[model samples]
Target chain A: MFIDGRALPAGTALEADIAIVGAGAAGITLARALKDSGLSVALIESGGLEWSEEAQDLAAGELGPQTYATPDTVRLRYFGGTTGHWGGWCRELDAIDFEPRDFVPLSGWPLKKAEIDPWYAKAQSVLQLGSPQRYADSEGIAKAAGAALPVARGGDIEPILFEFSPPTRMGEVYRAELEQSAVKTYLNTTLVDLRVGDDTRTVTTLTLARDGGPALAMTARHVVLATGALSNAQMLLAADSQVQGGLGNGADQVGRYFTDHPILIGYAAILALDPSAGGPFAFGDIAADKRRWRLAFQPSEAYRAAQKRLSCLITIEPPGPRFDPAAGAFDRSDAKWFGAPETVNALAAANATGPVRLHVLNAGIETRPNPDSRVTLTGKRDRFGMRRLKVDWRLSDADLEHYLLNLGDFAKALAHSGTALLRIPPDAAARWPEETSWGHHNLGTTRMGDDPRTSVCDRDGRVHGMANLWVAGSSLWTTPGAANPTLTIVALALRLADRLKAEMAA
Target chain B: MSDPVARAWAVTRRTFGATLLGALGLAAVETWPRWAFWRGAASSLDALAGLPQAAALKALGRQAQAAMAIPAGYADTLAARLGDEGYAGAVARDRAEGRLVSIDGWLVPETQALAGLWLASAG
Candidate 1:
């Protein structure tokens, strides 16, 4: 099961009623949901039981427009995929994201927020998080010397409501459950290509190559690709028989709409509420979303009104008497493992002479989607003999503009709220560091919509061209609201599971 | 209407709107970890090579983080070592100016490693 540098078990019987290409949050969640179905399932992963050097390499290097600047954000080849080391920040997509926002173009999900509300309720138990109802206890957190998030009133652009766990590591938390499954789990196996019936576009068989051997073929009644964003597109592009462009290449939409949360940090420092009073990006002053305790941001009323739509979270950390060793509050493992040293070096230099900034607040903003921002087949193969992905991440100028604008006002508010306002000089671009990469919430690649022409999948995560192929996870996100998207991804996966089950029964 | 604070507020509000508003409506375009391309392109032509896990996840360690929020005098050491690429010295500067002080709310379960500066370091 854990063989390396080669392909699948030699001459292995590769037949299953249902086949899932990844063993991540999406695949594992779905496999468990479909347990009793008469259909046998196959879950194939490129990596093995735990983290490995081989897997880490897939997460590194540059791929077209899809660049993995922060290798730490993903566990490229693992049993639970990247969920092997997730930060557990959970939140549901806003009602606005599900509904057609009057002002947002190419917005809206096939299903409504109400449809997934029940699913979110169920997912909470799986993630081992507290109930969503009592999530926000801002007053309680505020009483602490420094709570990082502020209390948020639901119903702005995103009426976000959900909670986070200390962070549910998929490998540590779900290994037992997976082992108990009757489902066949093929580790160290990568989906290299798809063979299609000449006339019909339906995928006839899945070809997998593990380590480095001749490809092995798999036949299945249905195929579900729960591969992370980059690999999902890579597999489709490599499936050359049915379509040269890729499996869901009808509109050439596989890698398009490449969007990452433009998380700007240190751009603004809330000047001086009381260094003692708790305001800004400090832990104590951080406003929670409804009942949740995490610090979050939304468009400033000014930006909201004009529709700049970008929002920033304020984290005013309590002047720590000492760092909480128990909480391990400061050891950002993901950052250390994946951060570009050159970039952080520049960021640190920019902040070399400031007050003890309480917390580093991130501004998670949505970027405009461009069809050109996409994944193309690089024709380069990994050790597994499959092609790599090319990432074209183009950000809009408008993003940088407002973060700076908000920075100025934020500093002013902090000053008025209390301190000697801190500011980044207007021309400090060169002095500033490379922007912060997102938290691996890869979204919008196979965006969902009513029309198949514009998007790759329908609202329920079913691929348009294929009857049995489905996708869940951030990839279906048309609008990744400012909230952390894992909870939403889980919600969508649950929704898809329920739909699939119901349809199977019908 | 002519009060200095009010004047400052008005000018400040307009400037904020001017710069950050027009770009509203759009959201999250570039992706996180968008690295599949160059590696794939290289591999496509039979040129892809693997890197070490320690190097693959080199960013996941504490040394870099410890170095990120060095005390005022610490950066000068690396400053000489990294002449052109020396960190703009943001940590040292932010510390001296009280800018990096107690960022109370800007934390997640684990962000200390990123900045290292805490309340004791605050003014």
Candidate 2:
């Protein structure tokens, strides 16, 4: 049943066995998993089934140093969460990402990749992506495309694969399923505060409100915080009536170690292959099994281990219409070749005939978790009187060093193979790009770990020292990997659901 | 004749001469492209011997004319050399100037060089 919080009377109190805040990808996946499990579930969302400006303003926050998408614009406040605009690129984190590395500070996950492989399979189905076997069998793509990825193994670089989704929007994809289930969804209800007991360990009541409506309260045996990375920390920091700093923030680790994948245009090169030979290098056709895949390049695990560098993935893009001379109107006589006119003329003549294929290189670099890069509370409050967030996202010199070194290695590998000649201006490698871009993947604010002193939540996604409070989102990530986080986010949510089910049965 | 001052002066002069020759040798290696430009251009035609297409030779000629700032008739001589045994030498000149590079049997201009040509053609 869908309940409009606007229609509720003042002081209305709802009861359920499980009360989940934020009806996004994680919330919806958990609700679906708990359906018909003999437990009553209340899934609450801040917005209606669609977009609302008033609801989005609740996410407004200050960007401290870097230029980043505002919290309000980077994420959607609707039922589906940020998946509403996601590109649906999905890849599982490599085993190396979960291991404790000597070079990477604050790296390592409490759980191994094997522990979550089963949930990843289930997540594949929920995402409407094809079978996991398809990703395991790369030869299928080579057979279907009739050409292999021009990359070879046993070198400094290796090819990695990514699968695309119909870019599944959970609200649209699972709306009917949610309506048919026993989970009761309350739309336009915002989580205002969490009333904890005197011990500061157990949450007793949750205060909720809607625009132009009376405030309501909810009581539950178990509460799950599925709000995204930014809001999850914001909610925890704001719910500080019982604790001095915030609930589950005794170690001051609640909002620290914030991270995002820093992206930039790495290099440019021409594939020595003829235009006809470019077909195999392009995004592979959706196989007969309805799975579309693309290949990217990354340094091998051995190389990374030897170099002690963070993981990064290089994406190749074909030259678009921007390369067409007819489309571009520019003066050649005034063209400066950096003192190489013969080379310039030869390049123009080659481009006019379109004999060789051009490729642009872009990469996503993993920024190490830093205690200084964090989210803290601002003096100003939101519509519900909760303190707003102030985000200080930063990147270290190590991050820049890892990106440039790996790119240099990749360029050399291409040149050595006689496949292409890579060109990156010397200055570009000396410093980070002036304007850094990100995929809006917020992570690590409420990271998980075995030790309560280092992480906000335990390995099972439970808040430290709290029996019934848990977090479910990318916020629970121990370390952000090079791959997109949606697949892992959904997988972790499903794993949390199973734990909740087993606990309830016990 | 056995004075220590005269003996020291002779040793110093020999050491200085050897150091100067070593420095010159290193400089030549570093600045080979600039110093060898004429020799490399004269031999550029050798680099194109492997190319099978006459049109490819003509294209190289045109690029050479524009790059060398020579008249149209001079371009024909460069183009003929491009199709002869000296094609490799001609290509060496272009490569030294950052004009041409070979990839998978096809000789093409570097991306920067192409951009320059495109701009010139647009004008």
Candidate 3:
């Protein structure tokens, strides 16, 4: 049953076996997964089924030192969360992403990729991916495209594939299911405080409010903070009434180590000897198995291990017009969408000499974990009387230096294969953090680990010292790999749902 | 030291003559793209071989060396290496050693960039 928080009386109180805050990808997935498990679930969202200006205003916060997408614009607060505008780019994290690397500090996840492989497989259906096998079939997809990726032997780069989703909008797709399910959906409700009992370990009650109304109360046997990476930490840090610092923030590790994939566009230009030379690099979409896939290149595992570099994926943009597979020609009508004008001009100038293809290269590289990159509570309060967030996103100088070195390695590999010659702009390194855009993937902050000092959650997604309080979503990620986080977010949510069922039974 | 002219020679006259005829023959069959690329490089070497000992070729060579800050006399060393290992071989070596520079937004092998700079200066 759906209940509008506005309709409830100011002093109303409710109870449930599980209370999930923020009905985004993680919250909805967890709520849906818990169905028929004999648990009475309550999903509390900060917005209505549809977006409104007033609800979006609640997402406003002070900007950080880095020029990032405004906090209000980065995430949505509605029923489906940010999946309302998601692009549906999905890929699982690499095995190395979960391992502890000697070169990277504050890295490694408490759970291994092998341990979460089943959840990722199950998440493929939730993400609307046609086939789970399609993601790993790079060779088959390349064969279907009639051109193999130009990966040279012993080269520092390897080809990878990204599968797309019709981008299942959870609110629109699962609205009827949610409406008919046993779970209670509360809209326009914001979690303001987490009240703990005398022990201060168990969260006995939750204070919620709606649109400047009087605070209401809800008690749950278990509480899962399914808010996004930014808000998860923001909500935890803002709940300082009970705990001195905040709930589960004894060591001051609640809002630190915030991370996102820093994107670099037009970082380098590629001049191919001919059109076929650039064909292997997914200048356009590769159609296979009646699904769309894109090919990109990343540093080989050996290369990263040897060079001590972070994860990065490089994509190529075709010059002139997009390639039309059916017509087997460039679609000039779509030329307006093409980026990298300099590459187009370069190719146009060289058109007479030969049929050369120019390509602009862009990269999405991981940021190293830094304690200074964090989210903290601001002095100002939102309409719900909860403190606003102040994000201070940062990237270390060493991370940027490693990214440039990785680009250099990719350039050499391309040249060595005689596929193309890559030219990195003179100011590529100096323009970082300013010229960089983002994947809009807010991650870490409430990172999971075995140690309480460094992480906010444990291996099973529970808070470090608190019982019955868990964190879900990208905020539990210890390291954000270069892949998009939505798939993993849902995967981890399903994993957390199983854990919750087991814990409840125990 | 060997004769400056011989050391600077990228292709011997006999090889250049044979390749020029071969390139013309292949052009009739529309298969001269590979040779056409090599012919341009060979022609640049031919021009460098004809210049004076203290010509602009040496100055352009120094410029290329300064971009990488390796050594001062790389022009002669690269010229000699280009003579010993053909155009493809020398370029492969430069790629292996990461000795390439971006000239006007084009990544050029150090040896090839020096030759192009010399040709531009000569013109």
Candidate 4:
């Protein structure tokens, strides 16, 4: 049942077996998983069914010194959450991402990759990604098309694949299923304060507010804060009645170690090849039983471990005529190409007989977690009277070092393979592209770990001191890999659902 | 006939004439393969020589060489001061700074003189 919070009577009190704050991807997934478990669940969302300007204003926050897309603009506050605009690029986090690396400070996950592999397969079905098979392992596509990836297996670089969704918006995709479920969804209901008991170990009740309405209270056996990394940290930091900092923040690590994938664009090369004879780096499409797959490149696990580098993915796109030197000299101010004669000649020759078969490179790099990068509460209040978030997103020098070193390795590999001659400006490592961009992957604010000092939540998504309070979302991620986080977020939510169900059943 | 300046002029002219002839012979020998290749692709040497496309291509080649030109003896100095890696690094830095222009067919600093040397060894 879906209830509009504005229509409720003033000072209403609600009760439930579980109360989930924020009906986004993680919240919705968890709610769906607990649908028929005989547990009365309250799925509370701040926004209405559709987009509203008032609700978006709540996301307005201050940004730190580093440049970023405004928090309000990058994130949406409607029922489905950011999945409403998500590109649906999905891949499982690599095995190494879960391991404790000696070089990376505070880098291991309490849960192993093997523990989550099953959940990933289940999540694949939830996201509608057909199978878990690697795109390169798809038989005959590479051999028949002659578009094999040049990077050798067990080498410095290897082929990786990202399965695209109809880029499923969770609200749209699961609305009908949710409508039939027993869970109660309250829209336009904002979680205002977490009322902790006198002992200060457990949350007794949650205060909620609505636009132009009296406050509401919800008491639940279990409370899951599935609000995104930013909002989750904001709320925890704001609920400072019992604890000076916030609930479950004894060590004051609620919002520290925030991380995002920092993307750099200028480091690129154009590979010239015959139109008839396809290049190894070109995007390959394969139709398997019912799924469509696209191929990409990533460094092998051994390579990343040996080099002590973060995960990175490279994409190949067809070069445009504008990038062709023979077309005419481009203004250095506008063009990304280096305008090398050999490159132009190669492009011209490739286009001489038929279509141009040149490939351009783009990469997405992973950022190592830094403790100083975090989300804090600002003095400014939103319409619902909750303090807004202040994001201090940061990227370390190691992140840039990994990006350049891997890019240099990619160039050397291309040159050695005789696939194409790659010329990298020697000091390309020293200079970064002016416009550094990122995917809207908010992660690591309330990371999961066994140690209470470093992480906000335990491996089961429960807060350390509080037995019933939990967090479910990318916020629980210990480390954000280069791959998109939606599939893993859903997988972790489903895993949490099982634990929650068992606990409720008990 | 007995004047020393006149004798010197005569000797210089003779030596200059011999050097010019020898250089022309070497150039012809070096370019023979390229000429032959073009001849085979085209109908004949005369047919290829007079075509506007041939002239435009030659002009384009010259333009490419000009774009890749560097200072006199700069390559030797660079090669000496910087090893191969350092030289490549310097060249890359220069190109990035817009101090060097890159031609499509040739590497940076590929002058017309280098083209001649490459052609001589092409056979």
TM-score of 1: 0.67
lDDT of 2 at A87: 88
Candidate 2 overall lDDT versus native: 0.74
Better of 1 and 2 by TM-score: 2
DockQ of each: 0.01, 0.03, 0.12, 0.03
lDDT of 3 by residue, A1-506 (tens): 78898889777879999999999999999999997799999999989999998888888898787999888999998999999999888889888888888988989999899999999999999988877666656777888877666664346787778888888999888888888999999998888899888888898898888875677899999999998998999888887887888988999998899988988876676656434664675457777877778887888767788878898988877654433233344333322122234333323344323445556777888878888899998889887778898889988778778877887777767766656767776666777778778998999889999999999999988998898899999999898878899999999999999999999999
Candidate topping TM-score: 3
Q: Against the unseen true structure, what C-alpha lDDT does each candidate score?
A: 0.55, 0.74, 0.78, 0.72
Docking class of 2: incorrect
Real contacts retained, model 2: 0.04
Q: Estimate, for each residue in A1-506, the C-alpha lDDT of model 2 and write its tens digit.
A: 88899898887879989998998889999999998788999999998899989889998989977877788988899889888999888888877888788888888899898898999999998898877656544556656756555557567887767888888999999999898889999999999898888777888898998887767889998999998999999988888878888888999999888888887753334444334446545543434445677677788778888888889988876555544567672134222211134544555455556555445566788878787889999999887887888888888878878877887677656544434545554345444544568878988899999988889999899999888899999998877879889999899999999999998888
* Chain A of candidate 3 compared with the true chain A, TM-score: 0.93
The top-ranked prediction according to DockQ is: 3
Comparison by TM-score, 1 against 3, better one? 3
Ranking by TM-score: 3, 2, 4, 1
Instruction: Provide the lDDT at A400 for model 1.
Output: 60
Query: Which regions in candidate 4 have their CA more than 4 angstroms from the true location?
Result: A135-146, A274-281, A284-289, A320-334, A339-358, A430-434, B1-123
CAPRI class assigned to model 4: incorrect
What lDDT tens digits, residue by residue, belong to model 4 across residues A1-506? 88899899997889999999988889999999999888999999999889999888888999998888777987789899999999888888888999888888889899998999888989988888867755446234455455665655546876667778777888888887877789999999999899988888778899999987889999998999998988999888999977798988899899998877776655555443223335564464544445555666787888899988888888765554544566763334323344444434533453443333445566778887788999999889987888988889988777878876787676655443434434354445555533577787889889999999999999999988887899999999887778889999999999999999889878
